[model samples]
Target: MKQPGIFISFEGIDGAGKSSHIEALAAAFRGQGRVVTLTREPGGTPLAEKLRTLVLNDAMDPLTEALLVFAARRDHLQQVIEPALARGEVVVCDRFTDATFAYQGGGRGFDLAVLSNLELWVQAVPTLEGDFVRNPDLTLWFDLAPAVAAERLASARVPDRFESQPAEFFRRVADGYAQRAAHAPSRFARIDAALERDAVWQQISQVLVQRGWLGAAA
Candidate 1:
């Protein structure tokens, strides 16, 4: 396979509008004549999609849950992400490894060292075929308060198990993302999600333009 030019990941607490934004962003990329592949972690393939249901459902243990998440990710990378990237397409992921680190490691208070070990093991899988994969090229972190996010979620029809978690749990996850962004500012763009929809899009648009992703005429 070949190396991709860019890999972006959108991450946020529940109801942060990442799904909507990722779709818009992919369209924007297409406008620039870029081939973009949009996928989600814990999904993007048949087996991984099933793992997503298991991970988000209410019956898995913490350790088992963490392992399952990584398992899906490994398959996602081999079958979907890496292949797209190797074809020189821009892979815009809905969520990525940071999710597990935040939700399971930080919110659930799992050992971070264990998370690292799991990543190492997964990356070494033979099917992975020696991908020099670092983290995402850019991580768009939609920053929003847990209370606000929960309020938005309440307006939606079905709340998943993660969304059904306590406010404090989501709060911890939000903080975890902030801390991660602080540690890797160059790779993250923390968007203020408390703003109105257009305002948030404007901010994102500005970032895209400044980064030479969106054209001045756009």
Candidate 2:
């Protein structure tokens, strides 16, 4: 496949406020006359959404959770992401494999090598360019203190399994994301999630402009 579309992902801890801006960004793209596919990990396609519920609500082993997330990811890629990209639409996804590494590998102490293997197996796609692993062209990582995030999450909604984890777990997850960002500095734009919503959006808009994805007027 020759992909002409752009793939972007928003990532952060549960209360980092990344989820709140995804649709707004997608709307900006839409306003530019771009076709945007706004989707989420572990829950894009029908089957994946079912897996999402199980993964979020059920009590399971660390390895079991990782496996389930990757399974949903595979289905999501095949059923939603790939098709949207093939059609030259912008695909904006909320969370992805990064969350698996954060939650499972870092927080739960699963093997990083195992997570890497799953990423390759589940995301590698055959393209005219060769065997290409599906990865976001741009990843916006919302960075916030775990305590602040916990406070935000407290009033947002009922806590799910992951959300209910202790602050220490979230600290580890944040470290995991930091490691990933350090390893792939060019692909990630770390945003301060503690900022006001408008300020955060301005940061995002600046990135879009710098990337040539949006005009200055936008």
Candidate 3:
């Protein structure tokens, strides 16, 4: 869909503190008079949210999990993201298709080619030049070592199926994110999540300032 809104996604392993910063970012954007749609992946619309529970808590094969996520994504895009963007609203998503690549393709050892095909089918938009893939305009990757992330998660709350996985799984997920960032350097702003929370916000703030999404003082 063609529109003027900016699509930004926050990504990281669990307990990287990315979720805590999302609301602040939204408030900052709203202060600038921008209409903001703060949402999350695996669930944005009603159906998608249901799919999210299944994908997160249910027992399923890798390919099954991957397909379920993509299905939810398609619904989410149609129901929430695309509509908001068409209205010239900023869309700040908690996670996006990248999570699938990390969780399913990297963590679960699924095929990247399969994910690629699904992405093309679900997200490609036809443009005059060619078929353009719909990716986040900016991706803030809260980069934390898996060991540190695991420690943080340990005290947070009950662990979901994905969260309950061994350290090796999270390591693979982190590696997946790193590979994606390397492949799309211009679109990713990698933040060190090992630092204090305020320090992490400062990094994000600087990125927002540089991008003209927020004022220097914001």
For lDDT, the strongest prediction is 2
Q: Which scores higher on lDDT, 2 or 3?
A: 2
Model 3, residue pairs in steric clash: none
| Candidate 2 local lDDT, 1-218, one digit each (tens) | 44379999999988999988999899899898889999998899999999999999998998899999999999999998999988999999999888888889888989999999999999999978788789999999999999999999999999999999999999999999999999889999999999999999999999999999987766
Candidate 2 local lDDT, residue 97: 85
Better of 1 and 2 by lDDT: 2
The runs of at least 3 residues in candidate 2 whose Cα sits more than 4 Å from the true structure, single-residue gaps closed, are: 1-3
The TM-scores, one per candidate, come to: 0.92, 0.97, 0.96
**Cα-based RMSD of candidate 3:** 1.9
Candidate scoring better on TM-score of 1 and 3 = 3
Runs with alpha carbons beyond 4 Å of true place in candidate 1 = 1-4, 124-131
CA lDDT of each prediction against the hidden true structure: 0.84, 0.92, 0.92
Worst 10 residues of 1 by lDDT: 125-134
Candidate 1 per-residue lDDT over residues 130-179, each given as its tens digit? 64445788898999889989999998868878888999999889887877
lDDT of 1: 0.84
